[model samples]
Target: MSDAAIHPTAIVGQHARIGKGVKIGPYCIVGDKVILHDNVELVSHVVIDGNTEVGAGSRIFPFASVGLQPQDLKYHGENSRLVIGERCTIREGATLNPGTEGGGMLTKIGNDCLIMASAHVAHDAIIGNNVIMANYVGIAGHCQVGDNVIFGGNCVVHQFTRVGAHAFIGAHSMVDGDVIPYGMAVGNRAVLTGLNLVGLKRRKFDREEIHKLRAAYRMIFASEGTLRERVEDAAELFKGNALVQDVVAFIAAASDRPILLPRNGPTLD
Candidate 1:
């Protein structure tokens, strides 16, 4: 007998691969190509459609529409995929869509992510490990959210935007640009308000590192010749500080979207 404990009311397709100790709750629907890894729990009313593979120990709450078809009109039923990593908690009403062909045919989420209720991760969005998305957060297609980032409730990230590691997007913010590593962005049209000092401290960043990063942040966004020149100057000046280097390197890379800059002036802790 299979080790999986499947509720009688749940509908799991014959071709679906249910790993050991996987539990399918009442009214859950598993598609033909879905793969639930060991210790995965799908609460009642959860739907896993398309070619989706959820990693071990991930618990999904009720009413989540995971790995569904892409909402894009350009999606012509291609064999796209949605891959969720281990220990992810997908809360109620969250919607994660599969990728379109143009966006590499895979929407991937890394380990230990907390996707809160009603958050929507659109087609081909790549979310890194340890990310947190509060209720009603919306990530548009092709957005890249880096590791340990946090998005407050109701924030909407525009298509093709990139939010770097350790960044924070405040509630109700609309991000239409790239957010640099360790940047804290907040506004209707999100601007880099400051460094995520609280987050860095909570993550155990040393005092000196934070101080140096603060210095680098000030120089990078000061009213200078050009953003590119400021970035180069910060890179050279703070080359020894790893955290500052990360932001500098991120700015050096070419992006389809413009990066979010600090609003008004520098904000320091």
Candidate 2:
């Protein structure tokens, strides 16, 4: 309220809820419905519009556009929200959009995410905590990205795709399918290349757990059995191993996108 530091050049709406210690820099525009939590900072030239809530301790760099209207043609001025969680860093020129009524009316980004410069997160996407999107990454609407996922620069994900936890997407990839947890995907129309063994090790995953996951992955992708049959087999074989079972369950679950598989394997779709 009174303690907030609002630059004279900024145009913050009278109805905007500015929390304690918040800072609004020069030439920024905050829409009437925006709720900025404590200690949030918007660098110069940032624009946050629409029905949006930015959590505490977040910093948005100069020229970043947040909480803008969805790009979807079907959106018709419906009441929607864009929620960004705490400790996030939205770099310069990044655009984060609100949701449309067609897709749950919400676009949410979890805590501690790093969205690099020029990255675009479209409407209705739910990004998990600790995620990192490198420069120029574009995530289409309704995509679900799991926690700790990493996207390389210029990677583009198709709408409604699901990328599981700890997955790695290589630069310049065009991903149109589901990537399982701990998987590594690369190339145009990305395919499952292998497990993210490097990520697993970096995150301190146990060596034996990694071994079991690798074995389950091979069995699931083996050429001898149908995809469904292989999934079931892996489910039964790795029943007690959560790491392996996570992958098996992701495959078993119903999704709008097909599961990404190795290029050498059957698509099974």
Candidate 3:
């Protein structure tokens, strides 16, 4: 609450708003239009740019770049914003860019997410709550990563792709299309191997729900039936389960780039 509590070595711009009980370490740069909510902590050498807002209880480590300008060529310097929700942890050397002119004007990270060191969240990306981005993971522009999703180290998510809730992406994989909820995807160009049974079990999914998801995966990825036929079959079989229905719909609606097929199975083509 006291101005003396702020490290004199840190440079807080005249227009910057520092909240009560905030702790800013030495040599940190807090720019104008930056708002640090209650009890936030900025470690040494952190750079929080203008138009950036850090919510309550978030901790930004040293050398991390929070709310910088968009990397897009079309940005044109439009005063876009970057908003980090409450209680998130941004590790050292992480770079989170703001939104571009084309993809709205805000890049957002939800509450309680853990963004590991050296991770890059590009312009206009939306990361949901409880998502884990392991070290060196790169999320490209306009990507929408759902809640509770886990990305192993060095995973690269393509632009405009949607990774559904509870999906698990293995290390060193490349995600180009939409990853369905509760699915396990791996490999260089990630493929859906099967239901994320381990994750589902850890999340305490009931047996019936797991069974339904397995059945849906079989119908969509393993069946000999045409895409339409497989979708119809899955629709009938998984009528009551919304998660299964979402998988079915995602597979059916996928165009240009379909979800990855299982590696060990017979080819669907």
Candidate 4:
């Protein structure tokens, strides 16, 4: 702690391990079992508690609460943890809680994430790398958010929901089910809308790959058959593309949660 650039007014617990080049601004309070890796910055008035480990280059803004107690009633004094990776931005007023006993006792946030102001990550949520959670996004307990996912503002994801990689959830939606990789979803009880074509394009996916994914999406969501049959058909038809393979794998790996599907017949194109 002495080697770090900590403000005189801050209260860092003696048991905390503050790495070199870490900066604790005015009025920051850190708990005993916390580890702040190199170049971590607390802007001001940030409260980090419980068993938390923030990796290198992560920054915490004013009034953010990291690694606090779980909101769940079942979390009765277990020594759970919240582990955050490198280069993340925890914006003002964000509340990220540690995990519960039932939810595996670990909440993990991956690298290069931007958790915007007023967003809440509940107990045991596993947010993947490069994820952007807009302001007011609420992620409930045990949600598994995959890499490069984008959550529009004011959206709430239910507990145990699985949002796969490269998926996009539109603004004001409520997701209670599983969203497949690269799929777009938007609604109150969010249904899968289509492939994230704009996202794919922005991320520089090849045109042929996008077309193939679109075709596979249509085949899988076609009306007039069981989801299993449609997925099988799509899998057999588009087995060449790795993107489609990921989608198929996600569909097949779904648990008890309902899979989001396109609401209409052909709204994607």
Please give, for residues 95-205, the per-residue lDDT of candidate 1 as tens digits.
999999999999999999999999999999999999999999999999998999999999999998999999999999999999999999999888989999999999999
RMSD of each: 1.0, 2.5, 2.7, 1.0
Q: Write the per-residue lDDT of candidate 4 for residues 1-269, one digit (tens) a residue.
A: 66799899999998999999999999999999999999999999999999999999999999999998889999899999999999999999999999999999999999999999999999999999999999999999999999999999999999999999999999999998899999999999898888888889999999998888988887888886988898888889888999999999988886456888777764676
Stretches > 4 Å off in candidate 1: none
What is the TM-score of candidate 3?
0.92
TM-score of each: 0.98, 0.97, 0.92, 0.98
What are the runs in model 4 whose C-alpha is more than 4 Å off? Answer: none
Question: How displaced is residue 197 in candidate 4, in Å?
Answer: 0.8
The lDDT of each candidate is 0.93, 0.94, 0.85, 0.93
**Which ten residues in a row are the worst by lDDT in model 1?**
248-257
Q: For residues 1-269, could you state the per-residue lDDT of candidate 2 as single tens digits?
A: 79999999999999999999999999999999999999999989999999999999999999999998899999999989999999999999999999999999999999999999999999999999999999999999999999999999999999999999999999999999999999999999899999888999999999998988888888899898688898899899989899888887787786445989898853321
Per-residue lDDT of model 3, residues 41-96, tens digit only: 99789999959999999999999998877778888888898999899999999999
Task: Show the colliding residue pairs in model 2.
Answer: none
Q: What is the lDDT of candidate 2?
A: 0.94
Ranking by lDDT: 2, 1, 4, 3
